[model samples]
Target: MGLLLKTLFYSSGFIIVWAMVGYPLSLKLIDRLYKGEQLKKDYSIQPTVTVMVVAHNEEKVILEKMNNILELDYPQEKIEFLVSSDNSTDRTNEIVTKFIKEHNERRIRLFEVILRKGKTNAQNEAQKTVTTEYLVMTDANAMMDKNSIKELMAAFTSNNIAYVTGRLSIVNQYVNEVSISESRYWDNDLAAREIEGRIQTITAGNGAIYACRTSDYYDFNPIQCHDSAMPLFYALQGKRAICNHDAIAYEKAGEVIKDEFNRKVRMSRIILKHILPDINILNIFKYRWFSYFYFGHRTCRYLLWLSHLIVFVTNVFLIKESWLYAVTFTAQVLFYLLGIIRGVTKANNKQLTMIYYYCMTIAAQWVGVYNTLTERTKPFWEKAESTR
Candidate 1:
């Protein structure tokens, strides 16, 4: 019993550390050996493209988003804005229609999916109308950098490139403690994706700034995130899904930690549901070097909640074994204590709020795991309240 407990303690501890630290370090080592393919980026070429914005109830930002797209640096005639409405009952559809009529912008179009089957379903239904070869998908609140489209298209310099995702920056990162921590989290995420992109394919892409050829776009399960699934989806076919950091998009971070937590829960659950059923990822012979990264970046990090739980549970059992164990256990307890204190007192201390946000993140992942286990995952999209 003691041996098993010790094993659990050490093993879970390593996973918690590895998911947060070791994976990025290993990627840095891999970077030296992996010199990815050279790009033949040509800024002069303007391929006709469709910007697909999937919205549920986005009246708050729909018109502004349309304006942002209109002001983008892409050749005006070469770009088409396709707004895919997922059974939106709000003024989202009306506002979009009104904007198009007021400007007489033939380039802007709206399509609706009344089934409420979710964002993926909405995109799938709307995709039938896309006449362009390459499609860029963005959230309604995501504002593209002036040269974002050109940079994304530049990365697709060859047929071997499956997709190109851009870096995301939080426009309201300094709004609050939650936003500050979220900004830091995104910085780490962008760094990780940048490293993985250097390996020829990224593990995943986000909806805020992701682009792929219309022909290569998979009809994802209604419950799955294309952002989470498409990078691997294209990789399985020997195509590179690269990240272009020069192509940037800005989104407002949720002001409240709990709102952020719920968003993470939905994301984690959706990612797990999408990845677990695909046995192709485990076929090392097929994925080759990418299988190593998939395990390190996606699977290990997704299962972090389990590791956190095991480490916490086993720490209580092993506290009597050594002074070192006691010290470590006490440190863990105090970390949670700080988070709780800040939550209860609404304290303005920077350090404690950050700790609280981190704890809420882990807790959300645990809830995601619970939802996945209980078959409670749904095929509906919920926009963060603070975002729209």
Candidate 2:
């Protein structure tokens, strides 16, 4: 029993530490070894494209988003806008209608759903109405740069590339501990995507700003996350999904920790319920490099909470065996205790706050997994208030 507990403690601790630190370091090293060069942008090849914005009660930001789309550097004649409203009770549909009437020449079209389905369902319906060679899908709240589309389209210089996702920047106006931690997380995520793109292809796309070939687009399961599902589909079809760092979109980070935790919980359920069932993705022998990276970068991330929990429980059992184990066990307890203190006091220590946020996020994932197993979680969509 003692040997078994010690072995489990060391193994789980190693996985947790590797995922937290070694994974990012390894990406940086691999990027340097197999550096990739970007293809030259060809301004002459202007293909017709459709910009799809999936919205649900987004009246506050719809008008600004329309203006942003109209002001894009891409040719207006070649661009078509499709804004889908998922049975929004608010003035979201009216706002989109008004925009379409005002900008008739911009080719802006609106699709409304009487029954409220999720964003994925709305997007799946919108794809059927597209009449362009390329499709760009973005969130209604994401304010895109003038040259975002231009940069995204530039990556399609090769027919082998199926999709290209832009960088999503989280700009926090009222900076708090949660916002600071989230900003750092996104920066590291962007770096990972860029490195993965250089090595082979990115594991997933950012729905905030991503473009794909219209011919390659497929209807996604309404319950699945389009950002993850679409890129995985492209990979299965033997096509490349790369990140275009120059193409940028901006949105605010969640100001509240609870809101962020709920969002992660929702995403965790989606990954477990929908993503994991796709057995073809786990067949590493067939996909080779993509499968290796997908398991290491994405699968490991989703299972991190399990490893964290295992390390904690096993450390408790092994603390009496050695001083090293005792020290580790003490450190874990202290870290979590500090997290609890910060949570209760609403303190502003950056390092301590991040530790608290990480612990809470893991707890959220565990709750998500439990809810998923018990069939307590639903596929309904609710926009995070703080992010808006």
Candidate number achieving the greatest TM-score relative to the actual structure: 2
Q: What is the lDDT of every predicted structure here? A: 0.85, 0.83
lDDT of 2 at 347: 86
- RMSD in Å for candidate 1, one decimal? 1.9
In candidate 1, what residue range of length 10 has the lowest lDDT sum? Answer: 270-279
TM value for model 1: 0.94
TM-score per prediction, in order, is 0.94, 0.95
Alpha-carbon lDDT of model 1:
0.85
> Which parts of model 2 are misplaced by more than 4 Å?
273-285
Best by lDDT: 1
Encode model 1's per-residue lDDT on 105-135: one tens digit a residue: 5588999887898888888899889999889
Candidate 1's displacement at residue 246, Å, is 1.3
How many clashes would you count in candidate 1? 0
